[model samples]
Target: MIIQAYNFLASWQLFPEKGEYQSGNRPKSGYYRINASDDKSRLNIEHTWVTLENDAFNATFSIIPDGELHDFENAVLADQFKASIADTSNLEISFYKNDRETLHVLHQITPNGLLKITQTGTAPAGEQFTNIEIYHKQMSVLPYAAAVSGAVIRPTEEGMIRHKALTAMEEQTNMQMDQIRRQIELLALQAREIVSRKELSMLIYNARLNFSPVIGQVYYLYEKKTGDHQVSMISPREWGNGSGPFKTFVAKVKLLADHTWVEVE
Candidate 1:
């Protein structure tokens, strides 16, 4: 019987044949092409190879007795068989001849494209075997097309990568903007300091002048205890007007530096 199998993990279609077989419904052997789906991820096999015949094989596999027509009633295989086929792997097949007799076959694929088959006899009704199951594990079906020879890439995975890249770019932009704002604030502070220095220099220059002093010259003045005042051309304002018998002068002076007058002398 023609047997066809599918490997979901590798996305491969396999045809297992032993010898030449013929049926009225079988087609001539040729290259069959399947077109990709709209997303170019899934392949759609043509309709000519979709149906099952006495000789043709597809995703479904069945067994029939010798020298008989298609017997759908006594088929012992499951509706679907799940198996993993790699370069080198092993598989077990069991067949029952009667209620008291059974046969077990172990098929191994070698690295050099040879199948090693081992046969053994087992007791009938030994143990009831169920399906295969693994604990605490789950497999996700990929929504995108995966190449048979390379790593699998999912659409959600690509989206996550893009999201990370955008987040990093946004953070970098924010950092640059903060740096620019800080630079502007620093420049504004320096400008305020410069203006304050200019104003302090102007105050010092003004304090150095007497009532009739020159616009840019430094001088000193003194006020007597009797309400009379004295003006001096030199600093420290030590010369006082002695209009009264006892007179004392308040010492007030200005200094000069950097071509400007400062009220310290």
Candidate 2:
């Protein structure tokens, strides 16, 4: 069976290191590793974000595994059961999977001793894993006073910042001008009348020749004479004015590599 999507729910405990104490003098730093599994096999799972709490870190992974059906289980388990490390302040946790580092989270304890976390990494795409590892390093905490001092304006730095800002503004203006130019060109094409059958066909093929057509775009059009259908390039002239907007009275066709349209179901 072809699987379009997969959904899973898993919960596991984060055990402390062997002989590590968890009392008033709790361990300042530690890590946890969890795996995604099925009944008899492990799934290849990839994720971003490694959260850390006072006692445990809970995670939920809903992912689309890539690879052959037979290896899905092992892939998920192997990929998920990687290494994690905590820094001295107990504020950050980094996860490593598949021999590569992935997911970094910085957390802080609230006044009530609750964990508050912020994560930076490649987010899940369509709930799928694009890469086996996704994470970010080079994170730090700067005091508010240090930040304020760094933001203080120096004459030389002010000039550089102004120059960069002006450059960005100019680039944005140029992009807007280019968009306006394309719009004008499209409007000109739409104003022109179709002169001949060959010209109309060419217009349909080269969507740029007429604003009403889009080249390399798929469209379903019906042929009246043969009751055949075609997946045509989006050309308003060819398929726009058919027998009503939606009607089923033709065989379906697909464009082939040799520029031929073949009938399909």
Candidate 3:
């Protein structure tokens, strides 16, 4: 065979076996529990090895009722035990009894999954008291196991999603109400302008007139008496000297060719 620039495969080997693609040494840590089954803290593993397969096995184990929560207590277990065993079908756990270190009553999500506590004593796991952070007020003692059962104070994924949905709905409703209020205010302003124009048109039409009013001519409206109104050719500025025909100036208007009264700018 011709050699490549870097390397070359000169010949094919004669073999009857299939090639092994990968070959490397891996740590067998899971078997440690099975080998040390006789030991007290061997963690009570059965003959089954499926749980330890491909597992890191670096995970440590600890019991409940510790006065101070260490690394294994906080990392591996919840603060309180709900004593939930309903979903134990999917859990991968193995435990042995140690009154000192073994948590007979477990409420934690282990690295493999849920905990399976095996008690070696006659006491029913409930008698064990866990580390409930206690503070004495008057006449109290340390390590008081107050068993209260109701519901776990844990926020769920569905609850968080519902909260966000309600918040968005509230914001949307407020915006719609503000838009409706603005529309109502605009309608009120338009109504007021219409009423003012109608009153002005009525005054000019009812005023006394001896001559025919010309189209496109500006005229001033004034009050003849306290209640009576009139139209005049003289503007308010020109009425500065001896203008007694009308007293109070009302508005300025222009006559349209259509015989309809229109106000001047």
TM values, all candidates = 0.24, 0.18, 0.35
Best by TM-score: 3
Candidate 2 lDDT tens digits, 66-156? 3221211233322442212223223333344465434444433335432333444433342211211111111121100000000111224
Which stretch of 10 consecutive residues in model 1 shows the poorest summed lDDT? 144-153
| Candidate 3 lDDT, 76-189, residue by residue in tens | 233322121223221122222231333333222235422222222122344443221111111111111111111122323543343345335545776887899899999998
Tell me how candidate 2 scores on lDDT: 0.31
> 1 or 2, which is superior by TM-score?
1
In the predicted model 2, the residue pairs found to clash are 42-73, 42-74, 43-73, 43-75, 43-76, 44-75, 44-76, 45-76, 103-135
In order, candidate lDDTs are 0.34, 0.31, 0.37
Task: List the pairs of residues colliding in candidate 3.
Answer: 65-130, 65-131
Top-down TM-score ranking? 3, 1, 2
* lDDT assessment of candidate 3: 0.37
